[model samples]
Target chain A: MDKGRIFAYLITIIACTLYLLPLYTMVNVSLKSPEDLIWGPVAPARRLYFNSYLQAWEKISEPFFNSIKMTVPATLISTFLGSISGLGFYRAKFKYKDLLLFLIVLGFYVPPQAVLIPLVKFLADIGLYSTIAGLVLTHVAYGMPITTLLFKNYYESIPKEILDSAEVDGASLTTLYRSILLPLSLPGFAVVSIFQFTNIWNEFLFALVLGRGRASQLVTVAIANLKGTTLAAWNVQMAGAVIGAIPVAIFYIFATKLVIKGLMAGAIKG
Target chain B: MARYGNLQIFLFILPATVLVGIFVYAFSAWNVSISLTDWRGLVTSIRFVGLENYLKLINDPIAQKALINTFLLAVTFIPLTMLIGLITAILLCLELKGTSIFRTIFLLPLSFSFVISATMWTWMFSPEQGTINSLLRLLHLDFLCQPWITSTEQSLWCILLVYIWQFSGYVTIIYYSGIRSIPQEHIEAAEIDGASRFNIYRHIIVPQLKGETIGVLTILLFYALRVFDLVYLLTGGGPALSSEVLATYMYRMTFNQNLFAYGASIGTVIFIIALAIMIPFLLLSRRR
Candidate 1:
């Protein structure tokens, strides 16, 4: 290769390696037996061990199911709400329309720290405190801003003429959404669902606060608690972390373009 | 659509509007009220103190440490991530062989939750058996090894490294898209004008990324303001509260110590800071 090309390749290689190092170490350490862990982390694992994975899975199974129960409903409800709202904002003409949409989307920017104090008390007052249902409500509420924005922006791409023509055909709002917009929005739904699913699944703060204790705890909290409870069981800890991450990692790897598109759409337009 | 009347549209959007309005905005206001009180402990009675908590926070050393540490992390984390991300984006834009693979690898870290990354990083920063130190030892560079997460002076920096690792990929994807959106003709025209590749990039491509820079800055600053998970998980704002950011400090005050009013005050401060950072960016973008 030419010198300039070689230099570019060299830098890219080094950057990629830097990015991959932690992941490599996590996987490597998880596979090492306790006896092999006596050697420093730099050394390759002497043998691949599945014991840690089994133990970690056993430890986190309840929380894993709780995460699923929490995440699925949260993701589905948020995405469904976002879709209808996106269409509503898209099709409906009202005074201060842009301002109203802006205000709604502005919810995306509010830090969780801002709402956390009131959230805990409110959930408790509603008698859902420290429960998986409370966590679901929290995620669904917080997930609104981004999910709505994603759907709004996604709907914006569809030609308004579709709605115009549908209206001309005597189609009502629900009919237009069901018969026209929803059909066109399948891909958008997929992208937004994946985005919401991963976000709600990976969320920690709400899970930590509202879903405290073993019964209601989500997987992220479970993994964190695993880390805290285990002193030197790095293998189990790493294994648990990996297991918690597998679903999102698969989406990230296979649907990278969609993920990037979701990110840019949510970020730049907002 | 004529059928899309105000009520109909409102009904469609009401669920989210009401939820977010109650959960985010209303609760935020509630937090302000709580901050104005002297309600500490698990007491049901709230006695209004009217900015006393804020006033006390001005004199509180722990709060000062947290504010300074937050500023330091923001000042260090954002620019460093953006710079490295920009550089990596530029390199990947070279379209070298296996660039897609590199892109995938680079962006993979963004998928990991803070808990997972923190877990991995804590082990990596273990002073005695950490990955970095072990590598240093293997390479016969003992002098380079230092106390990482265990020391007050370096703990914040260690936390910053993990933050960079987790987020720089996000910045990279944004900047990469930004760079890709730049018209090819501009670079081609510069090339035809006898500009060296370095000069073309330095003068044209890099400078054209101003919008991306701003976007990245706003997002990074947002993360900086809301940083709880990683700091809470990794350092627990420990080593004498050296790595304490406002979020962790607020969390510790409220949950751990039950200083409800004081914690709410800290939350109010975070809320205001988030607004201060966001409004200008919003206005600037709106004008654009």
Candidate 2:
């Protein structure tokens, strides 16, 4: 290999290692008991310690389940809505369709700060305030734009001839959707739902403001509360952080390609 | 044919359209009207006050500081992330073995929640019991140890470093994909013309990434403008409000203090800034 290839290799490796330090710190510190803390985060732990994980689990396990209760329903509902909405834009052309499409997509662009106050008020007015159902609704509502956009983009990629031929056979709309588009959309649902899962799982502000009660608190909020103590709590906090992160991290381990596709879908089109 | 105004198509989109209309667009409109009021506290005193809250924000010292901090954070992190991302992309595209693993390692941070990152980064940036200062001491450079997030001078920069750490990987992957999508013939032609690897990158590869650059910059802009979780969690906009940005300030004002009108005003500022950043992206995507 030439000097250039060698230089490139060196730079990439060095950058990757340096970028990984904080994560390495999380895992390393989590595995260390208080007695091992003297090594000061750089040295390997004295032994494999599971105490902190157990301790952290005791505190965060409730919110961990809360996160699941919120995320699973929200992901399923939003991705389902996005599919039908996206397919709406896909199959048929209509007047003001672009305008409506633009409006929905525009929703995805606005900062969450823009709508926070009214959302709180509106949710309370409807009596769903500070509830997991409220969070699920908020996520689904906000999720429409991207989910719709993704499904639209996904459906658009399928050749127009397939749809035309199906229509020519006098197939009804339900048949066209159920028999043809539904089968083709499994991968699309995977990509969209994974995107929504990671996003809602990681979402902070909405949960912070809307899901303030312990009954509805998310793991992100729970983990954040763990961050209050500075030194003595490091081990447990890191463990909580690791546990809270594991759900999406599992996707990274197993379905990295889908994760990448979800991330890049909008970017490439834009 | 699946004709326009087909009852089925309209039915399919109704729920999403209604939800988006009410939650996203209408609430945004309500937020704007609230910004024009004197609404504060629990009781609904939606008295019209024009833009007084907005005008008050102009003289609000904390708001001023937050604006400057947000500007500094954006202007610093976005370009730095882009430059780092571009360089990393180029390096990874050098036909190296195990490049996929490198890509995963680089992009792993993107999968982490901001809260998780906030936790890890806070530990790393803690002044006394932190890894960074610990490393400095282990290097026998104990004198160089500094109060990281605890020091106002270093707090924003600490957040900036973490921001770059979190988002640059995503940018790198985008740029890598952009590089891969660049047609090979251009690079080959440049090589045939005696272009060195450096010259080929400088001349052929980077120039063709205009779309990716636009996309990456806008995405980074969106993140920069809304970067609250890390700063709020790590420093809590602390050490004298030095690292406070618009999002944190907005949250504190609206949620913590119940200054609904004032918070809405700040939210309006955020919305405007978002529109400013988004319109170009919108127009560009439309054109394409």
Candidate 3:
């Protein structure tokens, strides 16, 4: 029994160590000076330099704001659209319901790379390329399927009797959704919000290809550019990474339970 | 009775459906069209090139390398991630104290952007002053040190290691949920029947977790094929395209090399590969 306990502890420690390796490296890199970075491999600096954080801050502030602009609206729009569609699919009898649902889910499998060039061209022709609105619209379209699927599943889990009762009381669709279904499904909304937020925030390829200038560049693109141009500025790059990652990390930490529950809920339903 | 409800449903769903159809499906078709044309550098004067782009792709060395590397990376990543995930899930399911804390710690990586994760890992594998080599020296194992991200032989492996570190936690959570769904009665019955822990796991727990396993495997496989951020950040398919995956190679072809049509051809190939794998799986799961 004692041996088994030790073994379990050992496994846990190893797992935790593996998990922390990248983070540990990031912290170490963030504390080093540019001179140290160029001179050394990836070792700790002679002393911790805090100026890198400032440099990274100045370099990324615009892109950071751009990211926020893109991610927040995208998350809100996607989640709202998803919830409404999910409710529609769940509550109302629709023509070609199965086909519609399948189409929504099919969006999940379409590799973003598969449509990159044409999307770029299409958006460029419409004056949406290199614009924040364009990026948000694209994100919304991409995010809808998963978001809708999540909400639809969650709505399905709600006992049909409650919805029926609301209908019998002459509650209209909007009223019923706002007063009952929405409140009851707040947790699902929170889950979808977090997922969409993380996805939009972390998205790089589209942002890189679409958002060319500093005016619309996202944090991921900023960080990538920073890394490429400021090779010597390891600390600054790490600082940029830390700053770029902080908001999503904080969001996930706060809603970890909700996120896990949401994933399981969606998976089981699917 | 249902007239108002139907109107409401249409109103609620039409916007999202239309957007998805126009952007996703329409764009996908457009992608196919571009792949067939001689479009280059901003889609000007697109001329139908038939299967010329694809035929060129079949013989292109970089594309061949990319196809092979993508398969290799997925092959390495899926099993390794599944193994680590399964182990961690099983361990966590043992009802150990502080499991929640462990879960949180493990999940911390998933919260960070893939760019951040890849950047951090790249720093760790830095040849000169990286923590890995320092730790190795500290433990008197100096011989194992090498330039992890830059070396041809090691670049792909390094990327795979980073992926495993970042994603194993996610799969662990999935498996944990699956394990939790198993009824307690079954385990107790096996225990009462003098079945060993291994026996109960092999016979009961594994069988019960099949659905979750399938789900995780399919998701992981899809993710592996589409992997971009880590490979892009870590090596940029470096050391002479040794680490190039389909996504990265396609990006290079379009943006870096200005081979828009060829890139689209590659993207079309990727779509076909993904559909080839996913369609059967979807059908099978639907049948079940």
Give candidate 2 regions above 4 Å deviation.
A230-232, B43-46
Which candidate has the highest TM-score of all? 1
Interface RMSD of each: 1.5, 1.8, 2.2
Chain A TM-score of each candidate structure, as shown: 0.96, 0.96, 0.92
DockQ of model 2 vs. true complex: 0.69
Residue B123: error of model 2 in Å?
1.5
Among incorrect, acceptable, medium and high, the docking class of model 3 is medium
Query: How far out, in Å, is residue A177 in model 1?
Result: 1.1
Q: What lDDT does each candidate get?
A: 0.86, 0.87, 0.83
> Sort by lDDT, best first: what order?
2, 1, 3
Best by DockQ: 1
List runs of model 3 lying over 4 Å from the truth: A33-48, A265-269, B3-5
Clashing residue pairs in candidate 1 are none
Worst 10 residues of 2 chain A by lDDT: A261-270
TM-score against truth, every candidate = 0.97, 0.96, 0.95
